[model samples]
Target chain A: MFEHTENINNEEYIPETYIPTAVSHGTKELWQVFWILLGITVVDFIIYFAMGASMTRNIIFILMGLVKAFFIVGTFMHLKFERQFMILMIVLPALAFIGMLVFGLLHEGNALSIDY
Target chain B: MSTHTTVTNTTPTWAGGRSPFNVSYGKLMMWIFLLSDAFTFSSLLVGYGAIRFSYSGHPVTPWPDPALVFNHFPGFHGVHLPLLFVSLMTLILIISSVTMVLAVEAGHRKDNKSVLKYMLITIIFGSMFLGCQAWEWSQFIGEGARLNENLFGFTTEAAAKAGNLKLFDHVHWDMAADRTPGPVPFASLFFIVTGFHGFHVFSGIVILVVVYINALFGTYERRGHYEMIEKVGLYWHFVDLVWVFVFTFYYLI
Candidate 1:
């Protein structure tokens, strides 16, 4: 229960550490992102059944997954509102690591395919 | 210090007091942690992919068909539903993430009532997803799948040749023990990857429950900013995003 107080100058009363400066994402924007994510996921579910198994389907699934990941990180995680430097700091290293894994796996596959 | 003489009034470079990213220390650290965690997951998934693609076409036991393997829907009683339940679980997780973001938005507006309400909703949704996951795991184990063997008949040489393996047939439960200790990477990888992700979901639920209790106690109200909620929101979204990858590799692929 919060105490009721008159319009007293509470500047000195409030603790410095208690300052609230979180960026306000509008309610409408939040809902918009939510809908976008749900729609994409539904489409993803549908595509699996529609396309069955194929190299193309696998590629499409990966691309669509990246798209969904982008939306979740950009909107729900609030990465879009963050500064460019911060975004680069996170995204660049992650991409680099993923690239390394992909290329490394490809090389391994090539070696495995060759019979002695 | 007493002997030091001031040259310029400007702040020292070493001090660098301001946040380089214009964000709080807690948030910056959370991002770093998530990035490292992302690498860990990527490595595991990539390793699974490598092993699977290499051996899928080989004469050895083929990778198990995810559709045939995970076709159990709760309470449907022997009904075969390929990916219907997992997709529903994904949707629930995404919905929980939406509620989490809404809670952060409410916190930004300093609307304590809305924040608490949204946080509670998010926690409920997260709990539901975990419940579905537990049921799915139980079905898999009950069907005789384990780390040692792929219970699915198609994952064995003889069954692959016979080509008449029914999904979730109780008769084949003994067939798992009959098969030689062939390459069952599918079973091992399925358990490892999903197990790790399940652990994350479990921990996320625990953290969300704690956050919900704090919200009920009006702790965030006193703190003036629900940065804690925002941080947890980052984690929840990451979990949701990771599931996208898991669903793609484990189910769709």
Candidate 2:
């Protein structure tokens, strides 16, 4: 139920409910991302068997997980095409909060183990 | 009306009358919602890490190794296939994500036929993943993993034997000989984290079905935009994103 009106200056004026037209952007990039994600997953599987359980292996898995998150959020969710401000608004807060929680609580857990 | 000016590179992003994110109100809200959801999941995972770490030096019942506990595979009875079945589940979720993006891409072109097709495929794969989770949970429960207790703990002898076992070897659990009660939080956290992620997948499937029905009736076609698909697509992708972390923290580590 959007009202269509012509501005006096002949410029298209987008109203509050304005939804810009959807464009196809083709499926090429989507497929490329799919392949890259699958490839990294395969690497994850291989490394799991190839390496012993150690902090190094665990760090590798966490780093690869972050890389996968980049693709899924950037391309699959279409955040990469959004405005710069929007990207920072979503990404920065998450990194800060999650990072702090993980490191802080894990240190606490390690201390609890020592006391036991 | 005459005061309105065309948006250009020099225009201040926060100026009124337009979306600073260049997304519709609904899609932007979906992103915000997902950001909040991410925080919720992070808390659960971080808590899990803390509890697990605290169990490291328990003299009576050391923390159970995940490989020994989650080694069963369908049709391969007693085989020690750690990480294999969950790996299959990961593949299913990732493939379904691809189909969902394809559905959104089809929506972009206003191709309702292709949209419905891809949507159906995505829903099917989503359900398939749920089925796998159901089986995995049944196996865990059958082995006496409960929210209040963990029966997967091994005696020193059994733990030594488990360390020497190779892939594809038969894994027989002798409750009396091998298992003692384990850290209570291990079983509890497993259920809470995976259960939460599973519930999200279930809800995502329900939402996708509703979106698919709407498209079948030409709702998006009549509305002149397929942004609904895009919005729901964002939610579905968010589900997949959460699974990546769950798979990493819960299973792989």
Residue-level lDDT tens digits of model 1 in B1-253:
2444434324332344333455677787889999998998999999898878766655555566687678777777655567788889988988898899998888888788998899888888988988888898888777667898765544354555434444344333345554443347777888898889888888888988898889889998887778888889888889998999998899888
- Model 2 chain A weakest 10-residue run by lDDT: A1-10
Best by the lDDT measure: 2
* iRMSD (Å), candidate 2: 5.5
Cα deviation of B147, candidate 1, in Å: 1.9
Stretches off by above 4 angstroms in model 1 are A1-20, A112-116, B1-15, B155-182
Question: Can you write out model 2's per-residue Cα lDDT over B6-98, one digit (the tens) per residue?
Answer: 433444546665556667778878889999999999999988888788777778877788888888899999889999999999999999999
RMSD of candidate 2 to the truth, in angstroms, is 4.2
Give the winner by DockQ: 2
Tens digits of lDDT, candidate 1, A1-116:
11222222222232223332676859788788778878887888888778757899999989989998998899889998886778999999999889999999977666655132
